[model samples]
Target: MDLVQLDIKGISYSQTQTGAYALLLSEIGGSRQLPIVIGAFEAQSIAIALEKDIKPPRPLTHDLFKTFSDSFDITIQKVIIHKLVDGIFYASLICKKGKNEKTIDARTSDAIALALRFKAPIFTYKNILDKAGIQLKTSTSSSQTQSPKSKVETEIKSSFDLKSLSLKDLNKLLEDAVQNEEYEKATQIRDEISKRS
Candidate 1:
């Protein structure tokens, strides 16, 4: 099976699942997208990397893994979103250690968290995309719309819009949201902070 390359076009909070986030993968030169729900911490890690924020005092877990990989002279060649079983996505990391290449099975969230930190390409089997991806059906079917991509983009954009609130206000809102266990709101606030930086 051919591995169809995908890029992390965006990440957004999952409206249907509390404390979970939707990571959007856009097919290279194609109009299809795969949405995988991930945990909040993983989502924050990916968002921080994507936003290129370095203001944090302590490195996140993904950053620690990247540091470890660099220290060992290992390179992450790519990540493959290999399968979807019972509504869960599976992934693996392709790594190069010296002259040998190895694949390690990983949870999709951790794989993507590491992939974003390593700046590696992500791929998926064509059949997996066909099975898990919901194609956008447009009238006449001449040009299909990428509905998932647009939805994810819109959610992220809204979450990161600085004009939506003052920093002090957002911080206060974040504190209250976190206290209430409103992780979705907290993730949005975290995204807002990373976006601001």
Candidate 2:
């Protein structure tokens, strides 16, 4: 099947699932959108990469892996959202090491995060998009169906640091974070929980 390229257009909290985030993938040549629900940690990983914030004291696992690949002179060409099975999205990383091309199975979240960090294109099997993407009645209608200034976009820009908030406030903040696609705040909250335990 042919692959259709996609870009990460927006993310939001999943109304259908508690404590999960919905990632929206926008097709490059179409108005269809594919939404995948991912956990908070993965959401944060992708968000941090997207925001281009590299100030963490230690490298994140994905960062470490990317560093390792770079050190070995491996190049990530692109990432592919290859399949959707039983409502789950599947992805792969396309890498080039010397004269050989390698494909690695990857969680969709991880693949997307790496693709952003590597400045690589993301492709999805056309079938997957057809199966999972929400089709609109018209391209113009879909374009105006949601604006860039939607609630998620607004919240992403105004999110607060989770470490500075109390547990009670964190709960409320989580709601806002999900709405705004502030995965960094959500990740910080998860870390705070681990630290308190």
Candidate 3:
């Protein structure tokens, strides 16, 4: 089967599942989006990778993996979302070490995070996209529209008492949340910092 390239659209908290996040991947040059549910930690890792400005004080697990791979001269060529079984997506990393190439099995979430760090392309089979892709409704007005997930994220952003915390406290909390693998919380803190600056 032919493969279709995908781009990371965004990540949002899953309304149907507590502590899970919806990772949206849009087909390149297409309106259809594939939503994969991932754990909170993975969601945070992916978000951090996407945000070029927000850097954790310490290296995240994904960051560490990238550094280790670079040290060993391993380059991630691409990531393929190969299988979907019982609502779970399976992915593999296409890595190259000089003339040698290897495929490594990885969870879809982890594969995507590493792919971003490696600047590798992401792809999925057309069959899989047809099975799981959602078409977004185009709006006719000039006013910007938001997804339900985006609305929820906005609500979360406004609910936090970020004004009460000092910049030093917020940074400390951000670091602690990342260290504790509380990505959602870390995101809110990061947003607060972004707003302040």
Clashes of 3: 0
Give the Å shift of residue 148 in candidate 1: 22
Q: Can you give the TM-score per candidate against the true fold?
A: 0.69, 0.68, 0.70
Question: What lDDT does the true structure give each of the candidates?
Answer: 0.73, 0.72, 0.80
User: What's the lDDT for candidate 1?
Assistant: 0.73
Residue pairs that clash (backbone atoms under 3 angstroms), model 2: none
Per-residue lDDT tens digits for candidate 2, residues 1-197, read 79899999877776545878878777897977666778888888888888764557888878888899899999889999887666667899999999999999999998888888789999998877765555433234545554345544354346634455566655555444434555434444434543544
lDDT of 1 by residue, 14-128 (tens): 7647788877777898866676768899988888888874545898888899999999999899999988766678899999999999999999989988988888999999988
Which is better, 1 or 2, measured by TM-score? Answer: 1
Evaluated at residue 58, the lDDT of candidate 3 is: 98
Best by TM-score: 3
Worst 10 residues of 2 by lDDT: 135-144
Give me the overall lDDT of model 3: 0.80
Ranking by TM-score: 3, 1, 2
Q: How far out, in Å, is residue 111 in model 1?
A: 0.9
Model 1 TM: 0.69
